[model samples]
Target: MHHWKPPPPLSLSLRSCRFVLSFTPAPAMSASSSSEVAPTGPADAIYRDRILSSKLYFDVPPSKVPVIYSSSYDIAFFGIEKLHPFDSSKWGRICQFLIKEGFLDKKQTVEPLEASNDDLLVVHSESYLSSLKSSLNVAIIIEVPPVSLLPNCLVQNKVLYPFRKQVGGSILAAKLAKERGWAINIGGGFHHCSAEKGGGFCAYADISLCIQFAFVLLNISRVMIIDLDAHQGNGHEIDFSNDRRVYILDMYNAGIYPFDFEAKRYIDQKVELASGTKTKEYLDKLDEALEVARNNFNPELVVYNAGTDILDGDPLGRLKISPDGVTTRDEKVFRFARERNIPLLMLTSGGYMKSSARVIADSIINLSKKNLIALDSPLGRK
Candidate 1:
């Protein structure tokens, strides 16, 4: 286990102090059962039962487009959201652009239900969920130090609620994709959170949960995760590490956060980019990576984590990709899935800049223009 040093006494807030005082070691798991998908056993039966009984996989009306979102997906408090570099209202802004430009009607967008504790239990441990009760743990996961001072109730209502709603959207996107050729969740892609851990602004393992639900309810055996976020998707990588059913194609700036060496070992295809990688170089690597992924395994569902952080001049991502480059990147992934007749779901993940919303909305518009996706109503009007 990696050793961690405690902070100085003065820096430890009330929440952090409580968390530190109550901290305990996690129970070790056998190597065989470490993976989220272990061999058939009693635990497997429980997972299946929980998934089968979940309300998150409900059917959507044909009138509504498969663009999952909710107002609750955007978090806004007394400006506490500004503490982190992330634009907490990015999801709402993406929809606003689409609406203002008449590309999509707000009523046509599907609003997802909040993922309940039972739903979260399918991927997250009970202890992990309990740990979130301490605002300090959540603050650390989201990388906002001031959040440690807020009451847990306020944190849950103002912060975690939005994330849970997005988690719901991610899980539901898979089902929508299965039904409608392709779907997009306006918010989701918490790829840095695993079942037992949350970090890098990812408090829930939505990607992992989405695939797990698809495996059980959608009757699909194989999944491919095309994570284009500038950061490594270590959460899902670790969850599906030992499971042969999931294939991961991760392209990220290696000089970023969550430099998890152990998680890197689980990636089936890893394309590491430097800090200043440009649009052409990034796309070229993606083309090669997609070709390699195509030859490696056939997936029933493709989960695309289309993060706009790669756009040039982003402080966190540090990559030099252009806005148009992001559009082309999305087109490539959608075309890849369309060509193979595989259902695809795209999750807007990891991009934090204020311009991310405009760029994402533009990409969706481009996808519509390219005939790769249908944004209009009646279920099939491109």
Candidate 2:
């Protein structure tokens, strides 16, 4: 197996590095037009304080696009991440394809700060963060048994640090979405983790953290979660179960992992697909589901967990969605938010295959070509 390494510095001239993205913020977005009264009480006050003090919510200049990613998002120490089915290096690979194909400029991509411990406290319990200090606990959470043998410091640096960076990206995506109408964080969607637990290869509750930060920082009350990963998004479901402000629409293979019946109760709309479901049936169900969701909730922001694991031959997804099907699936979701004038934040959730990166890049390219998202070089002229 090949060891993952950071891409070498490009040979671009200094003049080329100064290209700026001239994107116009979407007009008449209901999310930015109004604000929800912030929640009160001591616990909420603490959460709000942490969010207010976070450095993850920094301002981005027009020179950078809303696509957030970093080479540090890849986990590759000792190659132990290969023990699991996940592509640990998929985030960097996705950006590499977009850059090499000229669909995106590397200089235009935004790099996010890592989510600090206090920033994580916005959603996770202090005890839960402490639990991750044990290498064995983290190993179990990620499902990589070999990681347990490593020292906790190495595990922290190699595994959890990347996840924290992704968590930061997820949190920052909401702010960027509110400004740009849409934002894509190429390495997030840790949907199986809750405030107190992390499992199913999810080490952090990035989705929950993102939404919580949105509630406090973005001043949005009504939020909708469109989770299309092959597995149930139990993390955010549990986190937002008692809160009426967040609406969840989850479509997953009920026959798969993390069958949390308790968390399933919280989903406002759940579409469970059986194993071996094909592309046509999947897309048809998505159409009906999106329609039902539109009628059910008028959310200010939409968080889309677009997992490419549904592609044909993904062992974990257990579905038969084609490459084109994936592309169309993304377009439908982008249109769902763009047409409604709602800010949208998309997280590249759970596609574990090596081809998942290429598939995701193609889908983003298609979104740009269809005028769903504004990028630096949608026409690939640069």
TM-score of 1: 0.90
lDDT of 1 by residue, 26-99 (tens): 21233223233433667777777888899988888888888988999888889988978888899999999999
The TM-score values for the models, in the order shown, are 0.90, 0.89
TM-score of decoy 2: 0.89
Query: Which lDDT value does model 2 have at 68?
Result: 94
Error of 1 at 178 (Å): 0.3
Identify the runs in model 2 with alpha carbons over 4 angstroms from their true place. 1-35, 377-382
Q: List the residue pairs that clash in candidate 2.
A: none
**Model 1 spans with C-alpha error above 4 angstroms:** 1-39, 380-382
